[model samples]
Target: MPMSEEAKALRRVYQREYRRTHPEQLKRQRECTRQWQRQHPEKCREYQRRYWERKAAQENK
Candidate 1:
């Protein structure tokens, strides 16, 4: 089921609060993602390709 607008808003608020309170953790997570992408460049390119494709399709709609 799709999330209601109120639920989505609440989620955004919670996420913003969490990030504000956990800067170190978020920084570590981003570093880990960067490391993974560096170790898997091909996989990352494939993922980006699919992501852009989906984004383009959404915009066309």
Candidate 2:
């Protein structure tokens, strides 16, 4: 089903708010993740394992 006009307007407001607040946080998170992956491959593997576990659960549902 298509989104209603009110839903679309709300999405626009939410998108703008998120862009203002989240870009720096996301950039920092990416930098930290990359540093972790570089410094500790084993720790990165554990993160990947949990990521796949979550993906599997979502797919099953």
Candidate 3:
């Protein structure tokens, strides 16, 4: 199901607050992501390709 605008806004606010209050956790998570990307370059590239495609599609709308 698609999220309503209000739900999306609330999620954005919550995520922003979480990031602001959890710098160390976020740093560790980023480090883990980087390590995983290094260990799976092809998977990372495929994920990035899909991300950019979705971003471009959104912008074109």
When 1 and 2 are scored with lDDT, the better candidate is 1
Best by lDDT: 1
| The 10-residue segment with the lowest total lDDT in model 1 | 36-45
Q: Ranking under TM-score, best-scoring first? A: 1, 3, 2
Error of 3 at 34 (Å): 0.2
In candidate 1, which residue pairs clash? Answer: none
TM-scores vs. true structure, each candidate: 0.87, 0.43, 0.74
Encode model 2's per-residue lDDT on 1-61: one tens digit a residue. Answer: 9999999999999989998989998799899978978999998889889999999999999
Best by TM-score: 1
Clashes of each: 0, 0, 0
Error of 3 at 23 (Å): 0.4
Pairs clashing within candidate 2: none
**What C-alpha lDDT, on a 0 to 100 scale, does residue 2 get in candidate 2?**
100
lDDT of 1 by residue, 1-61 (tens): 9999999999999999999999999999999999999999999999999999999999999
